[model samples]
Target: MSITVYPARRILTMNPSQPEATHIAVDGDRVLAVGEVDTMPRGDGCVWDERFADKVIMPGFVEGHSHALEGAMWDYLYLGYFPRHDADGKQWSGLKSVEQVQERLREHAACLPAGEPLIAWGFDPVYFEGTRLTRRELDEAVCDRPLVVMHASFHVMTVNTPMLERAGILDGPRVEGIMCDEQGIPSGELQEMAAMFVVFDALGHNLFEKVSSPHVLRRYGAIAAAAGVTTITDLYNPMSDEAIDAMVEVTRSVDYPVRLVPAMGVLQWSAEEGIARLQAALPRSHERLHFGLAKLMTDGSIQGYTARLKWPGYHDGHANGLWNAAPEVLTELVQAYHQAGLQLHIHTNGDEAVELMLDAIDQALTLWPRADHRHTLQHCQVIDHAQLRRAARLGVCLNMFANHLYYWGDIHYQRTLGPSRCQRLEPLASARRLSIPVAIHSDAPVTPLGPLFTAWCAVNRRTASGRQLGEHEAVSVGEALEMITLGAAWTLGLDDKIGSLDVGKYADMAVLDQDPLQVAPAELRDIKVHATVLGGRVHGGD
Candidate 1:
């Protein structure tokens, strides 16, 4: 086989054995050696790839917690508070007020095919200072068709009267997530999955199902490639046979930009059913399409006031939040999945949820006694040091929603969590002190899918309103970088294969215009990604 040597101005290998390198030699899709060109393995048919000669290269970033829905959501109108870039690198300006949001919806609705539903996403009510989007407002946007607006959290959604009537939500069974007005009229604000599923069923479209398409998956890859991400997880997948087949077909292609890890959503099946499905799918796993990772949902979003929190819940004296899965259900799933020997990524956004999951993990480990389980807690935004200690003892990794600091830190400080708890949100430094294996994430489509920006959030701990959230909980730039790369890979159990430029590992790398270590902490996110090299294939370079 022919060898290819990629010469770079500098390479941050992330492999401590040889921490830095000026060149990397690749044999096929795996790293042969990484060092100075003279020290690299020499071969008769060696080829020098100098595309990244003036750039700095690091291990391709691994996003431990994100969804393929990110790609699918772009097909709809974006209504986020912060300006965002789509897959094709087009910037969609942020909508500032409810009037602007409704106006955009009206405009987008007019352009949609007749009788088709109008779907919009990334709408956050917290930024509006207590102004909630109602079905009445949505009706004004597009009363004739079924219109739905998904919140930035994806934990809540608001629909027009047409959608509510079509979904039969007005007369639907009373549930924790179904919001009703004072006179018991359905408000069109559906909180969490169960309530949202009603609208999805009525609309004859499932967002998760929509994300399984080859086109959407490819778009997802493009988004990752643009962000210099080589490995990213679609953290919760329904895992239909068609979805699996589509992913296999897409990732098998040489042009596919990133390794896709789609965790089977346990919520979609009984414990036995999920286990059987995952066991059957495990054999289909490949170099680019990974399977066997399981995802469990325990609670809702804190920003939506739907996350289950412990005592002194919601600083403004709002009632306690909702649970996606009851405590008993969580315990049952944890025990079953753990016994089945599958790694789990459980979503626990609040402190109470964190405590419950920790207990469940403790029980499962005691019963099964498996070593190196690496079951991770996703979106662990409100965990305390005590919970961190328990997580450390249980060997549970944390994939923190660090981007929350930038997006909702001010709101959390003022309303949801109060000052004391908000200060402790996504405490990476605290997790490091306790030696708990940890990673930080964008939870993209909730925030955006840029690891550098996520790292910047952890390093700077700055809110959108310019508030310093938690200086004591802030981690250094080096530590934050690890959280996005190897640390994230470790959480996903892909560390050995692709986290760094170690010999025998996949030759995956992100080429940058500047070294993150050399930049100011505040300017870290500003550093441009020139390209990404996935398994030795260069993508998105000039």
Candidate 2:
């Protein structure tokens, strides 16, 4: 294999004592050496690439848990919660009231030719507390124009009158989640997967057939490369065989700019059915696409006040939240999959839901005794210290929604779980103390898929209200970076092959404008991707 040396001011291999190096030697798609310029051995007399003279090279950022296709789908549809500064610019996600939403809607609607669905995402009702915009509010915002405002939760959305009428949901069966008036008329709020499926079904065929076309998938890949992400665990792909084929074609077409680890979105499936579905997909493993695990959204989100919390949820005196699936249903699913030699990635945002998962995992272990399975529990948001200890014992990996601290920390502290349970949120420190392998995730579309910001959130734990929730739970900047790289790779069972820039590891790396460890915590989010190299090929940035 011909070799090329990449010389940088600093290289963060994330290899503990020797975290920083001066150069990295690449032979084919693997790193041959990472050390000082003089000590590096040349691959057959190949010279240095000399392209990264002044930049900081780090192991490419990996988003352990995210909805890649869904995030792309959101980009394909409505403007993000963040402002769309222009026709195409960095979007703004913070809007204060219904008036602002209407203004943005008018701007987007005016740009369209006519009759196009005015879809907008990332509008969280909790953000505009005391003034929750109902379906009636959305109707007035875009009169005669079809509109659908997806909640930041992505687990729910509030559709306008036109959208409701189009889907025939206005007078449909009284689904417990769809917002309704005292008269039992549809109110616009569509909560959980059941209600959202109504809108998704109405949209016609799956997005795989349209938005994620070859042309669009290329653009999405470009976006990932530009963002400095080399690996992402897609949390909510439709899991259809067609979707997998599209992704595989995209990856093989020109070497995917980022490696995709797709988790089959498993809902309403028995363990047997889930395994059968994986077999049906018949995905062939490649350097870029790995479809081995299953994603289970077992509970609703906390922001919508639908998470299955313990007794006293929502500081505002709301009772226990709701569950997406019953305990019996989840237990059977976990057991069947565990017995089938498949990995289970369950999404549990509430403490009660976390408890149920722990119980279910314990039962599965009893029936199918096999160690090192490394089944993961995602979105462990409202879990307790005790839960962390339990997770450590069971070898259940955790992919924490660390971005929750920045996006919903204040709401959770003041409204959702109150001050008492707030300190235990994320609990990375407790997880570290217990020797648990914890990974961080954006759960994008829930939070944008920005690994640096997620790392910052894990390290700082700063709330939207500018208050620190629990300083003790904060992780170091190094630890935060690893949570998305090495730790995340371990969770995906790709550590030996992908994580750090070590000898024999794949030459998957990113060049950032600045070293995250050298910058202020707040500035971490501001750093931009200078370049990204995957499998020794430069695909994005300068």
Candidate 3:
């Protein structure tokens, strides 16, 4: 096999054995060695490439809690508070007010074929001055065509009257998640998956089903590649047979860009059924499509006022949030998946819910006694150091919602949890101090998928409002970098294969214009991802 040596100004391998190198030699798709140019082995058919000589290469970022859905959703309009850039590099300006949001929707709707549904995502009215967005305001945009607007939290959706009538859900029963107005009529807001599914399916769009197509998955990989991400978890893909097959096919394709680790949603099946399905698919997992995992949403979003917090609940005095799955149901499901040997990723946002899931994992351990389950607690946002300690003892790693500190920190401090609890959110430093394995993620589409920005958020703990929420809990820049790279890989159980640019590992690296460690802490997010190399192939090159 021909060996190619790619030289760079500096290579920051997360590996401890040889942390820094000037060149990486790859044999086929695997790294043969990482060393200085002069030190590399000289042999016939060896190729020395100096194209990235001035670039700084590091292990590509791993995002443990983001979704592939971000790829396909760009087809819809984005009305987020933060400015975003699409895969094609087109910039979408932020919509700060409800008026801008309405105008943006109206403009997108007009451009579309007349009378088609104006579907949009990333619409969070959490910071808006008035009440939650209503159907009335949306009607002013376009009364003729139907509209489906998904909330940023991904827990709720606001629909216009045309869409509601088209779906014939105007007379639907008064349910827990179906938000109602003063007269007990269905408001435009639909909360949670169960409630949102009514309109999501009605629109004739199944994002998870669309994921079964190779075209969609390839586009998703392109988006991930642009973000400097090499390995990412779909986190909660429905994992249908067709979808899994598509993922395997895409990963096997020569053009595939990122490694996909999909955790099938447990809510899609009974405990027994989920275990059986996972067991059957264990042998079919592809090199790029890693499987044998399950996802359980233990509680809802904290900002949407739907996360289950402990006592002295909401600062606004709203009722405590909803339970995504009953305490008993989550516990029983955890035990079954644990005994079945499938890694479980539990979505726990509130502290109360974190405690519940921790207890459930402990219960599962009692039955199975596996030393290294590594079943993660995704978005354990409001967890305390004590619960984190408990989680550490129980061998549960945390993929904390670090991006929350920037996007929703101020709102959480002022509107939801009050100052004390908000200041304690994420607890990155405390987790590091206690020797707990922790990683941070952007949970893209909810926020943007930039690991550098996520790292900056952890290091600075600054909010959009420009206040430092958790001054005492800020981690150092180097520590923050690890959280996005090796730390994230550990959470995904792919550390040995891709976290470091070590010998025998896949040659995956992110090319940067500058080294993040040498830059200012606040400027970390400003560092550009020039390109990324996956298994020795360059993508998104300048």
Candidate 4:
């Protein structure tokens, strides 16, 4: 194959041997050399491609934690606090009040066919002060059909009275996740997966099944490409044969711009079944679609008041949070997966949950001695210094929800965790100081999918209200950039193949209009993504 020498204004190769370069030579899908044009090997068919001569090139971003639902979510009504753009590049305005939310629901309800269920997502009650969305309010929008609104956290959801009645929640046995009104009636609010599963069954809309469709997969690739990401994780997926087939079919197409790394959602099945399923699916792994990672959900979301915290719980004296998996169950799953030699990506949002996971990992490691396990804690928003030390000692990675500082920092500081606890929400700097492998994520559809924006949140710990939640926990721009790129790659166990622009690695890079390292910390998110080169094939550019 002919060698293509792509010259650029500058290349920020994360490789330490030659950190900066002016040109990179690509042979097929792999990088042949990264240096000045003269120093690179030349052949008879070598061609100099100066398409990005004025652009800065860096390793394409690796989104360590995100979901394919980000694409499927655009199909539903968006009721988030912040305005967002969909996969098709259409911008949707944010709803400011409960009244506005109801109004939008009413509008959407009128357009739908009679008796058809209405499902909306990204509804956050925190943004609305002194008010909450109740079933009665949702009934006023569409009393005849089922209406369910998913919270921004995706941890809790509210349903209309008709839907609650349809799901038999009102007459069902008392469940921990089902909230009750003052009169001991089902309040229409479902807290965690258990309660939500009942509603999902009644609605007959299995979201995981829908996410595997080719259309959703294509949209996910488009969204990732638009953000200059070359590799993204569908973090938690039900690895059904049909889902796997859809992923393979969609990703095998050359037009699909991003590579996918899907981790099996192990909680849906028994530990033995999950291990068996993962083992069976390993043989089907493709270049664009990777398998062999597993996910476990221990607790819920902090913003939704469903995450299990340590000692003094919620600031306003609300009840303690709930766990998706009981402590014993989580420990059993951890031990089984560890013994099976699978890298686990466990979700633990609260301090208590973090502690539980650390203990479980420790026990699992003690039972089965494995090296470089790289078991990671995702959305570890409320972990403290002591937990960081334990995580480092256990060889565990921490993928902090850095985007939380921007989206829900004020709420965390003022209501959920109070001032002192909220100050160290993500604590990226502390994790780095302990020499723990660390990464930051957007957790899309919860926040939004943009690593540059996520990096900026880590660099400047500033919330939507312009408050610096934790100045001490903030990391430098260089550190933040590394967290999004190489650090994230490390968490996913793909550091050797794609994190940096090094020789012998895949030629996957993000072409930028401005240098991220040269810009002001505040300007990092504003930097334009000119194009993304995946395996040497450019996707989008001017």
How much lDDT does each candidate structure score?
Answer: 0.90, 0.79, 0.85, 0.90
Q: What is the per-residue lDDT of model 4 for residues 337-442, given as tens digits with 9 covering 90 to 100? A: 9999999999999899999999999999998999899999999898989898999999999999999998999998888889999878899999999999999999
Arrange candidates by TM-score, highest first: which order?
4, 1, 3, 2
Residue-wise C-alpha lDDT for candidate 2, range 185-242, written one tens digit per residue: 8888888877777777787734323434555556556666767888877666666656
What TM-score goes with each of the models?
0.98, 0.94, 0.97, 0.98
Q: Write the per-residue lDDT of candidate 1 for residues 192-242, one digit (tens) a residue.
A: 988899888888899878767999999889988889899999988889999
Q: lDDT: which is higher, 2 or 4?
A: 4
Task: Give the poorly placed runs of model 1, Cα more than 4 Å off.
Answer: none
For candidate 4, give the lDDT of residue 31. 95
Location of the lowest summed lDDT over 10 successive residues in candidate 3: 167-176
The true-versus-predicted C-alpha distance at residue 180 of model 2, in Å, is 1.4
Relative to the unseen true structure, what is the C-alpha lDDT of residue 91 in candidate 1, on a scale of 0 to 100?
93
